[model samples]
Target chain A: MKSKKWLFFVILIITTPLLATTIEVCSDCQIKTIKAALSVAKPNDIIKVKKGVYKETNLIIDKSLTIIGENQPTIDGQLKGDIFKIKSDKVVIKGFNIINVGKDFANSNTAIRVQKSNNFEISYNRFENILFAVYIEKSSYGKIINNKIFGNAKTEINSGNGIHLWDSKHILITNNYIEKMRDGIYLEFASNCEVVNNFSTKNVRYGLHFMFSNDNSYLKNKFLSNGAGVAVMFSKRIKMMNNQFLKNWGTASYGLLLKEINDAEIKHNIFEENTIAINVEGSNRIDYENNNFTRNGWALKVRGACYNNVFKKNNFLYNSFDVSWNSKMNDNLFEHNYWSEYSGYDLDKNGVGDVPYRPVKLFSYIVNKTPETIILLRSLFINLVDFSEKVTPVFTPDFLIDNQPQMKPIL
Target chain B: MFKILKYSFYDLIRSRWSFIYLMFYFLLGVVLLFLNNNLSNAIVTLLNVVTVLVPLIGTIFGVMYYYDSKEFTELLLAQPIKRSNIFLGQYFGVAISLSISLIVGLGLPFIYYGLFISDKIFEFLTLIIVGTFLTFIFTAISFFIAISFENKIKGFGIAILVWLLLAVIYDGIFLISLIYFEQYPLDVFSLGAVMLNPIDLARTLMLLKLDISALLGYTGAVFKKFFGTNFGVILSYLILIFWTIIPILGIVWKSNKKDF
Candidate 1:
């Protein structure tokens, strides 16, 4: 009988590391705090938090675990510091209401921060009044999905981004609704990220901004009424498709501002009613295809040094200036685009216009040189002057013409 | 003065000219709303028409009414009515009739198209208000010109010239000068130039509401400060009111001194 009891004890000890036991945490339980529960948890343990308000701050997770909250338990940080700083791989945090993260200039007080972690899933969470929501630094293979972040960002001086990814790769950010942040989603030096189906609106700066981020593709994200709109700068091989940029109207605002970007593919996008849609500067070898630019101030403003860009099958409708160029130099190719202001006739019954359409208006050139001249837009004299300039190509770049202008808008 | 105003108002209303004007606006509103099918964009197109066409109609109608009623005006002058009342009453008559034609003409089609329920109702109201202001302003200028000149052809010619200058040529010159003086700061100067002309003031007011995004795109701090707030609207109203009053005062002065 003594030998048999020893054999059972040895088997029980050997199987303890593979089991994932659930620890219940509530106000009335023995382990009341998530911090206390996490301290006693194993690598694959599951912590279930009950429905209650827990005033906690700086909860660090250094081991792989699953933290699930029942009925959206509110974790009020009380404006102290970062909450739920994950430092280990394979951590999952779900169904928590986080609020009141502190604002510090040096170290951002993030709601859910993952540092040097991999395979983390922060989903089904709500954040409000946060300095930085979901701050991922040096994290890879993380999915920040289905999270709603609302920030009280009144000014750009002290505001932080909603989902700030720094040096993170292979991250998936999808189905997030972020509002009133400094920037909705900011990525710096991050690569191979896929951001899809996010609604970012009313931010103080760009809705989705990228700096030196490469091999990223953002699809079907809607950026509306942001202060400066979206900017993809200093990036290479970025693919943006099927996005809607609407009503981001202000002084010096645009739907998208691409600067020094190379080999980017922008297709199937809608730019509507923005001040300036798609302001390109120094971007090379970009293909802008099948996008709709409607009712903007300037549909496309090539500021300077944009070369080898191909604009094909895009529709420019009712914009004040279809294409405005600053310098007279032209190396871009515009083909098969349908301009609403194209008055040319296709007498041969072909889909293309008989004459090539010149889009760079002399008045827009003048307005670019002396921006105050924009006040004379749509005036009779300005129209006459533009007409004369159109009749005789002078001041504007003569080589900037759509050789095959579509008679009908590409659906 | 009220009697003369009523008489002139009825006289213009009963004429086929007012009917044509009313029908023109009705057709314009109907075609714009139905064809465009978007309330905001239709209002923009209507604003373009209102800024240009309203002044042309107002100037020509004012000058034509004055010359057509010349002998009747001389008869009224022989009566106990004051000269300022005589000229001012005729001016108000033309202005009010034209404004009513504009309102009733444009209002019917818009109200039919569910403008009151739409969010663009305020923009439509601004367009109407600016249209009325333009009507009053240009009519006063034309009346002053008609009262100052005795020769019928000369008055008509000068009236047309003044309209052309304010509507088209002035803007031409303003654009040229702004481009020529591009090296200097031109915010205050451009605003002053816009305020000096009633047509330009009305257009600026309309642009403040319609094309605010593009207008604010200019990098001038003064321009941004002015257009970004309600200050530009208030100043436009003040300057537009000043424009209306100046011409009426000119009519009063010119009529009081002239031999007609």
Candidate 2:
């Protein structure tokens, strides 16, 4: 019995080191480079890289392993191709500062490219001066957290996005600081992504852009001073909550641009000092509730073909124009919102106004036709024209009215 | 001249219309602050009022004060005062008194609401300075009109007409011209047009300070370049001083050659 137990112990001791191994890569170690370490690593192995600059490019990781940087080791791609091409499943990359990936129009150069991978994590890294920070393609069940991406992009045609995802599913992009990129966080043909607690500012294009993506939700993210705030185009069932779209001021800038989007829920967002708070085009069944539009040029500029949308419990405060519709046909419902310009009294002591509020003004329509007419925005002549239009349905839409306008702001 | 200015300033302050005007602005400030409870909103609302109503009141009150005090002016002319002194004194008197009413009336509510400690202090200061400039410009222009036409009806008619032209009709023509020439760049034209009208100039200054000049399109950019920076502010102040000076010079020139 003692001899049999000793044999079992000897067998277990023999097989234990083969299951997993920790390979350390430093200047003095036997595994002198990460490439050499990764070459010998098997599944579930950890390759620890010590603090140094690695001048390598197009480094492909095909084995299921963990790569960790001690003291934030630098990965200088030397303006070559992608730094890390991740193709294996269950790979983890952490604490690497990546810089100077190659710029190629046809290749879509990125600091880290994860393709056809699952259960991957790219976290606690800094990406700078790269074309695309993190490109995730056809990947699922990944988490991108606490990454800072800074790009010095000037225009849309030449610049790339901070975080670009295509055909990815079930990804969480959280707590990333992205600045001066083209589009801060871009998703195309991607779905089921949760973007939370990110700060995207001063981008050349939209801060958070969605094209043909669905079931995506963003919460508590700040889009500040981007070219235009957030653009959700050609998508459905998207939810945006508690985000701040602030100070996107220009002739063509807006807090949120919705084009051909449907069944979206936008709640508790704050739009402040944008040229237009929400520019809606051909969207349907969207619900905008509890959002505050403050000091914008136009609180809501709705174009035609937008139907079944409801704006409720929102505070439109001191915007130059509350709602400007391009067409006279009205199908959207504006209810229970408090407008600072509503001049009606609630005689019945109910919280609603006795007279319905018509938010579109004649000047807004005229400005839509002739953009230069905005120079006459607060002129007395425009006020006379607006007052006349309010008294009689002339140029503005006749049926667009908020019948239950609140006397005070709906908190 | 000093005595004349003092008496006229004191007299205008004691008048019933001055009290009413003061009361009007006081009430507006109180309602905008205490009722709305939003300092920025109140400032916006006050912006509209200051741009439109201040010019109107300046013109009406200047014409009325000139016509109502014709006898007093004639009496001062018969005394030892020079013609330029009498007219300049009265113009300064009306402009200074009206400005005081505006500042004090609006300042009370804003100070009460803690504007001193707020970030909007610069915006409020801009508002005050713009209001004072409007008062001075319109008052000087009205005095020029009054002294230019000896007939009371013509003076009053032409004063209101001048205000209407600057406040409403000039913008109408400006908008029409911009639309008619939409194919061409209107940046220089719009900038020149704004400089020509004191009201538009004031509005542009305030809008730039409020940081919404980006909404003004091409002209907004130009105005921002000419009015958004420190050089712009100094140049605007110089131009505004020029606007005030030109009208006052007209008053001095016209009043000097006239016989009462």
- By lDDT, the best candidate is 1
Q: Write candidate 1's Cα lDDT for B20-70 as tens digits.
A: 999999999999899878888788788778888999899999999999999
**Which sections of candidate 2 miss by over 4 Å?**
A1-19, B1-7, B10-27, B79-81, B151-154, B169-193, B218-239
Pairs with steric clashes in candidate 1: none
**Model 2 chain B lowest lDDT segment of ten:** B218-227
Cα lDDT computed for each candidate against the true fold: 0.91, 0.89
Off by over 4 Å in 1: A1-17
Q: Per-residue lDDT tens digits of candidate 1, residues A125-152?
A: 9999899999999999999999999988
Residue A237 of model 1 has an lDDT of 100
lDDT of 2 at B78: 90
Error of 2 at A357 (Å): 1.5
The stretch of ten residues in a row with the least summed lDDT in candidate 2 chain A is A372-381
